[model samples]
Target: MRYFFLLVLLGGLGWCPAQAQAPAARHTFALGPTDFLLDGKPLQMISGELHYPRIPREAWRARLKMAKAMGLNTIGTYVFWNVHEPQPGQYDFTGNNDVAAFVRMAQQEGLWVILRPSPYVCAEWEFGGYPYWLQNVPGLKVRSQEPQYVAAYKRYIEAVGKQLAPLQVGHGGPVLMVQVENEYGSYGSDKQYLALNKKLFEDAGFDGVLYTCDPVADVAKGHLPGLLPAVNGTDKPAEIRRLVRANHDGQGPYYVAEWYPAWFDWWGAPHHTVPAARYTPGLDSVLRAGMSINMYMFHGGTTRAFLNGANYKGDTSHYEPQVSSYDYDAPLDEAGNPTAKFRAFRAVIAKYRPAGAAPLPPVPAAKPSAALPALQLTQYASLLGHLPAPVASPTPLTFEQLKQAYGFVLYRATVPGGRSEVLKINDLRDYAVVLVNGRRVGTLDRRLRQDSLRLALPAGPVQLDILVENLGRINFGAYLLQNNKGITRRVLLGGREVTGWRMYGLPFAQAPTVAAGSPTPAAASGPVLRAATFTLAQPIDTYLDMRQWGKGVVWLNGHNLGRYWAIGPQQTLYVPAEWLRKGTNDIKVLELLRPEQTALRFLDHPILSELSGPQP
Candidate 1:
């Protein structure tokens, strides 16, 4: 073996052979003026992108195996800040969020790691992987050097660095390269910000090669002086070389940091899929020309919980929210199964892998899934019944304003002189279900930009309730500045402003107690919380079919199964067998829209690709 000597050195250093031997630490990774050097030998990153948070903790190794089987020597992943630190200063690296463990797992699987710890990772994830509490940091502007924002950024970097810096190749670990702020060129050309990012990495103990990645057009503006500039895209070799040359005086080791095998999907848009034939030849050309490439998503996993982000270019752009299933139509499906693209790409990678490199391990078998019997969610609880104490406010408060990150917010106003009028919520965020005195009125959707709904107000005193659902924060582009969900502006009724409001914060950070055993008073209110139990003889991965339901979120055994809508592309929720028990398991669904539901079901397969005619 070429790295046999390196294995002896590592073994002498008291490291376990089984975990650290295969991907021999032959050389300290370094960046040359033209190419990357491993123990002074030229190296290229034949990597596949995978996110740790997307895949379940139990499946990390299996996914790594699948990645290696696809002929990748390196695995690239973004460390999501929000997943690690949901709250400011409260970091969580345990369980699925344990990135260090993931890196070690990669090492064990004989793979190198490319760490992209973007405190703000715009992976169509909620708030670009930034903690939602960052919005509450008085006068904070993100992706910039605003003092509060920059301070928070540094702290996060330090925190993540503490966990991962020790695993760098320089420290005898598998991590070869670390990326600076992700796609900074697409956001801004702040040289100082880019330089600060590099400095932070150094200060935090990341001594290996640091690189900055941007789309081909943005490389010049995004790259810093000392850091390597890696272009991202599927551009032709000539164009890619031209772009790199224009940015830096380099003739060798071009790196496509993000080669898009496929694209991400917005809720309303059709599921994106690129034919394998469309890029295999390009892959061959790049490898032949000695360029390193990392597929954006080697395997796109589900966007669990309410972690999906939205997209809005600006005021004029359409507000499109991302669905829960982030199956980016990649080589590996969301379920971690190989696809046609996987087979084709494996063939291409096999052809291009370094001479005499070990043959890839056998492809892993697909995980078994089951179609469960229709589950009857007999128990019920309305959101109004489960709300915490009201935050009495004269005007409606945004989620950030109320120190709330996600879930729903209830804005209730007592209209004394009630009449038939046009009720306008000047800036309604996402989705809102209007209620007049606990009676359903009409629904206002942000996708349709419907802020006002006709109200037939009773002549007497009326309780006007506007329950707003914070779908997700805008993850990318210019609109990220205005990501605060809920009612941003004033509430108007019949051209007259409605004041005196009682706002209820339903972060739903924890699952609420519902009326169990028997149905709760015949389901006569807003946002019913339905409960059901299912028994499994032998637990296996199954999908909770949400076609029969309306819009809501599901919790299996108190674990958030993520948001579901009848306006599907994604009709079923992936319930991992790891989350199931051998006996009985409880399912709780907090459906927001349709309260007329009595039963829920599970399917053997996922329905993530069906486009419902045209989205409203």
Candidate 2:
């Protein structure tokens, strides 16, 4: 036994004795002058982005295994601040938010990890991954050096460090590199803010190599003096090397941080897709030039609930709210099954495997899918009937003022002896349904740059109500600064400011309860809650088809399945089998617009390609 222990210590034995087992092997990952060095040797990292919150916890391993089969050596992910700290100081790290477990899973699957724990990750997420409570902070400026912003950011980062700092490669874990603020230069050129971000990460105990990623044009502006610079949205091998070399000390450890194989979809647009042949050549060239690359999304699971974001190009005319399905036309489908693009990219990757490296794992088979018969939603409840007590206010309150994060808010006021005049809501964030005496007359949509509707008010003080929907906050560009939901400004009638409002906050943090077999009230012309129950012999992954339903949200077995609109593109919500039970399952729909048919079906596959002409 002693001889065997000696042999193990000297590395002469195949296995170590139980009592003589050494600590886990620690590694050094650094940026070399000409390459990324892993323990003093060059490593060509082939990584893919996958978010934990977007995928079900039970499906994380299966997705990671699929990534491995596609010949990925590294997995990149963003730590969404909003997902962890939904409230001001409250933090959650268990279940899908368990990022440490996710990193460990990558290591267990024989893959390295690159951590992008930026406070502002603009991956088309709501408010760029900022907690909605940030809007409530007095004199706080996001993505800036404001003292309050910095202090809050510090607390959040330190909390994250406690969860992941020990998982760095230096501590015998899989995380190799940590990213600073994501794509900072595209938004602003504040060197102090960038420096502050770097310092915060270092202070939080991320001792590994730190890096910054930006578009090729912003590389020089975003990168710090010591941190490595990476580029996104470009795959030209020569241009990548040039940008990195120009930004750094004239050397060549080039990395493409975000190579876009395809694009994302927004509401009212056709589903975006890129032919596999269009970008496969560029991918081949990047690999052939010995450059490292990370696909923007190997699989873009789903952007569940009100967490989806919108895009604004400095004006409301360009406001495009993103759809529920974030599939990204990636190598893997929304269900984590490999697509044709996966095979095409894998073939190119197989050609670049390091000499004598282990063979790629066999591609996993797709999970089985099941279909359900049409579910009739017989029971209904009116949203107005189930109102919580309102906050009496002289003027309309924004979502932040009411301490509400997402969903709808209702504003009620009485207009005395009104005439035929235009009803305008100043600074309407996204969408609003205007009602006069319990009748929905018209809607004000920010997407079309609309803020007013001509109304013929009845005589003798009619009750006026405006239900505003926070479609999503702008996730990118300068518009993000002014992304407060609800009525930011006062309502105007006939060019005069109207006051005296009662605001009802409807954050919908939990699914609203409606009594079973309740009759549809006579005044149920507005948003209604419809419910149905069905049984499944064996629950399999399926898509909830909402083509017949108008705009609203859905829930399956109490899980928020996400929003759906008749306005094309995303007609189905991907429901993971893990969220379903083998017995009876309850499904509910909150239809903002009345459904053409009060029934829904389950599809074995997703239907994200259909387009509707115009919304009602």
Per-residue alpha-carbon lDDT of candidate 2 for residues 435-531, written as tens digits (9 for 90 to 100)? 8887778888787778889999988898898989999898998877788999998799999888999998888878778678886665567778888
Q: Where does candidate 1 stray beyond 4 Å? A: 1-26, 520-525, 613-616
Return the lDDT, model 2, position 524: 65
TM agreement with the true structure for every prediction? 0.94, 0.95
Q: Estimate the TM-score for candidate 2.
A: 0.95
Please, what is the whole-model Cα lDDT of each candidate in the order they appear? 0.85, 0.88
Cα-lDDT of candidate 1:
0.85
- Model 1, 1-616: lDDT tens per residue? 8588877887788776677545535458876655678888878778999988888888899899999999998999999988787888888999889999999999999899999997778999988888888888778999888898889888989999999998998887899999999999999999998888888888999988888899977988898876778889864788778877666665545788999989887766677778999989988888877778899899889888888998888667779899988788899988888999999999988887678887777888888988888877888877777778899888888998898888999999999655689988887888999999887788998887788888998878998989899999999988777888899999999999998999999887777678777566654757788887778899898998888778898888877878888777777788888789899988888887788787777788888777663485
What range of 10 consecutive residues in model 2 has the weakest lDDT sum? 13-22
Clashes of each: 0, 0
